[model samples]
Target: METEELQAALESAGLSQYQSDAYVAVLELGKASAVEIADACSVPQARIYDVLRDLETDGYIETYEQDSLHARANDPGDVLANIRGQAATLAAAAEEIEERWERPPVDDHMVSIVNRFETVLDRARTLVAEAENEVQIALSPAEFEELRPALAAAHDNDAVVKVSIHAADESDLPDDDALSGTVTQMRHRTLPSPFLALVDRTQACFAPQAHSVNQYGVLVDDYSLTYVFHWFFLTSLWEVWDVIVSERSEDPPILYTNIRQCVRDIEPLLADGATIEVSVRGYETGTGVRQNVSGTITEATYAGVSTASGEHIPLAQLAGQVSLHLADGDEDWTIGGWGAFVEDVEATRITVESIQYE
Candidate 1:
C-alpha cells in the first residue's frame, strides 16, 4: 500500500489523481488490461485508456498488444529517474517564471499585483504557514478566517503568530473555537480597510477592497517594501486609538515597534525621580559612530549622555541608536531611544543586558 504522504507527493509531482491511481494499480497488477487496471484502481473503464496513454507518454508504464491490450509498469528505477528530471525542470521553470514575470530591480522596492481575491487569500495563507520565526498581521475578520487554518498549522509547527483584528471590540473577535488546540494571540483594534500580513519581517501582503467592489492585493518581497508596509500598518494601528485587553492573563515580552512605546515603558522611573542606570550599545544611525553609554536617564525618551532636550533634538544629533540594560535582580528594564528605537527595531539589533547598578 502506498503511504498517504507518497500519494500526495505523486499528485504534487504533476500526476493527475487518476493517473497516479492507474500507475500504481498497474504496478501492483504486474500486467493488466485497461479494464482490469480500472477495476483495480477504482477508475472508470472509459477513463483507463487515456490514463494509460498519459502514463505511457510520461514513461511510467509500457503497453503491449496481444489478444487483448496489456499494460505493465515501467522499471521503478527508470520511473524515478524520469520523475527526478521532471522535478528539476519544473523547479527551474518555477524560478524562471518568477524571474521573467517579476523582473524586480534590486535597487528599489518591487510589488507584485494579485488580481483575484482567491489568489490573494491563498498567498496570504502560504505566508503565514511558511513563517519560520514570526507572522505579524493586521487582518480583516474575513481575511482572518480565511487564513486561520493555515495559521493553526503554523502554530502547531511552533511558529509565532500575532494578529491584530479589525474589530471594534474584543467581543467582536472571532468567537468560533476552531483554533481550540492552538494559542493565537489576538488583539482587537480596528485596523484599516486593507488587510495586511507581514511574515518573518521579510514578506508582506496588502489585500484591500475599499474603492472598488473587486478585492485586489499587492505581494511584497523586497525588504524595504516589506518594512514600509509593516511600519505603515503599525503606525496606523495606533492611529486614532488602540484598545488593550485589560486583566488579560498572558504577558508577552514587549516588542518595541516605535519610540513612544519604548519611552512609555521607562516613564514611571523617570517620573518618580528614579535615576535608571541604562547601558546602550549600538552605533549612531547617521554617522555610524559607535555609541556606548552607561548612566542615569534624565528623561525617558532620549538615550544619550547629555541631559539634552529629548523631544527637541534633531534626528541627526543622536544618530538613532541605544542599548537597554537591566541590573541584576532589577525588575525595571529600559533599553531604546525614539529615533534609535525605531532604527533598532527595524534592524532587529536591540540588545538587552544586565549592568552593575550602584
Candidate 2:
C-alpha cells in the first residue's frame, strides 16, 4: 500500500494521527532521531517525542538512546495480528448482513412487512411449532413439503392443522399418505395461490403469489390484525377448495374451529332429531368478555338459499347470520362464528361433547 494509505490504516487501527504519521516515518527511515521524524511527517517537533513514546508503548515501534534518542519500527507481529483479526471480523459481519438481507430472522414486531417470502415462512414455522389450538395454512405443493415437518409437530401437539395445497395440475398433488399424520384436513386448490398461515388466531404470515406485480411478505402477531388475515384465509384460500384428505372423527367429541363447518357436519344429525351437545369457547358479543356455553344445539339458521346437493352450506349462505341456537336447560343462547357482533356469543371453538340418537 502507498504510504498515505498505510498511515490512514494505522490511524484506523487505533493510532492517533500524530502516532500513525510518526510511526510511518520511522518505518521508512529505518532509524530516526525525534527531530528527524517530526521533520519527515506532519507531527510538530514539540510533540514528536511524546508521539514516539506512545507508539513505542503501544509496541508499534521501539525508541532508545544511541548518542541521542532515536525511534525505530518494531517487528509489528502483534499489531499485524490484531489488524488481521479486525479484518476477518468485518468480513464475517458483511457476509452476515447479506444473508439477513436475503432472508431476515424472525423479528419481534407485532406486525412487520418483509421483502422475502422465506422470512414469512420461517416465522410461520416458529408460530406453528408453538401452536396450541389451530393452524390454517395455504401454500403451493412444494412449499407444503417444505413445511411438513412443522405441520407434523403441530399435529402431534393436537393442534388442528388445516392445509390448502394449490397447484396448476394434479401432478403436484400429495399422496393420501403424505398428509396422514401431519394434517387434520388437506384440500386442493386447482390454481396457483398466495401463501398464508394463521396460527392460534393470533399470528399470521402472508405473501402474495409470484405472478403478482410486486412480491412482499407480511408477518403479524397481533390478534386484531391476525383476525383480518384469518377471515381472508377462510374465504379466499380455504372454503372454496376441494377436500383431498380429512381425518375428522365420526364420533362425538369432535373439535371444530370454523362454526360453519361445525354446522355443516351436524346439520343433518340435528334434522333427524339427534340431540347434538357441544361446548362452545368464545367471547360474549356485546361485552367482549370470554365465556363458555355448553348445551344441546336446538337449531341452526342461515341466510342464503340451500344448495340442492345438501352436502355443505354454500359460502354465500354463511356470509349472513349463520348461528347455532343452543339450549342449556331453560336458558338459551345464540352462538355465531368468527366475527359475531349481533349474536350472543362469538364462537372461536366448538367441541361436540356427545350425540344422542332419538
Candidate 3:
C-alpha cells in the first residue's frame, strides 16, 4: 500500500489517532525532537512525550533522549504485523464470547446428543437424577421401560415419580417386583391425552402421540412455555388421570373437575385482546366441544364487559355476566349461568363452564 494508505490502514487496525500521527511524523522526518514531531504531526506539544513513549512501547517507533528528544519509525512490516496481531486477538475474544452466548442453555448438554439414542438416554438419566421433589412421566409402556432405570434412580433419590402410561392395559407395566418395593409409592395412571412429562414443575418433555412405539420427544427446561404446560398438565391431564387411576374409570366428576381446573388455570395467561382455547370432551349433546373465541375487553363506567363473536363472552365482560360461576376464595366472587367471574381491584377473572379446543 502507499505510505498514507498504509498509515490509515494501521490506524484502522487499532492505532490511536495521536499515535498514528506521531508515527507518521517520525517516518517523514527520519528523526525529530518531541516538539518537532508534535509540530510535524499537529499533536499537542505537551502530549508528545507520552505519545512517543506509547508508540515506542508498541514497537511502532524508536525514541532516543538527546538535547530534547529524537525518534525514528520502526520497520513498517513490524508495525503492521503488530497491528494485525492486536486485531486478531480482539476478534478472537469477540468470537469466544459469541460462541458462549450461542451455546444451548441446558447445563452439561452435549451437541452429540442429537439423533443419538444412547446419548439421549444419558441425557435423560442426567436430568432424572437431578430431580428433587417430583418427577412425572407421560410415556408408552415401551418408552417407560426404556427409562425405567432412570425412573428408579429418581425414586431412590426420594423423588415422587408419577407415571402416566398409554398402555392398552395397566398390566403392561413391569410387575411390582421390577419396582423394587417402590411400586406402591409410585403414582401410575393411564392418560387419554397425548404425551407429556414434567419434572419438579420445571422441566417438561412431550411427544405427539399418547401411545406410540417411537419415543421421539423434545425436552424443555424451565421457560415461560413450561409454566403453561405445568398448568395444563396439573389442572387438566393430571387431574383427569388422577380420577381415572383412583376410580379405575373415567367418571363425570373427573371430567368436570378437570374442565373447571383447566379454565381456572388458563384464563389469566390470555392476552387482553387474544383468543382463548377451551378443550372439553363433552359439550354438544354430550359429545364434546373444542372451540376458540377471539375476546376483547371494554372498560365501562360501572363495570367492564368482554365480548366475543361466539356465545362465550370475553374475559372483560365477565363482571356483568348474569349467570357466571365464580370460585370461592378470599376475593370478590360472582357466578353466572354461562361461566364464573371474580372481580379484584385490578381486573375481573373469568372461568368457562366448559371448554374444548379444535
Indicate which candidate wins on TM-score.
2
Candidate 1, residues 229-326, lDDT tens digits: the string is 76566566533344442222222223333344444444544544554544454455556576554444444444444333333333333333443443
> 172 in model 2: Cα distance from truth in Å?
4.4
Better of 1 and 2 by TM-score: 2
Rank all candidate structures by their TM-score, best first, as comma-separated numbers. 2, 1, 3
Off by more than 4 A, model 2: 1-9, 16-50, 71-112, 169-181, 220-228, 286-289, 305-311
Question: How high is the CA lDDT of each candidate model?
Answer: 0.61, 0.86, 0.53
Q: Which stretches of candidate 1 lie over 4 Å from their true place?
A: 1-109, 153-160, 168-172, 176-185, 189-192, 210-214, 238-260, 271-358
**What is the clash tally of candidate 3?**
23
- Higher-ranked by lDDT: 1 or 2: 2
Per-candidate TM-score against the hidden true structure = 0.47, 0.77, 0.34
Question: What is the C-alpha RMSD, rounded to one decimal, of candidate 2?
Answer: 4.5
**Winner by TM-score between candidate 3 and candidate 2:** 2
Q: Estimate, for each residue in 61-147, the C-alpha lDDT of model 2 and write its tens digit.
A: 899998888988888799899899888988999999977776644444477789888788888888888888799999988888888
Worst 10 residues of 2 by lDDT: 102-111
- On the 0 to 100 scale, the lDDT of residue 90 in model 2 is 82
Instruction: Give the winner by lDDT: 2 or 3.
Output: 2
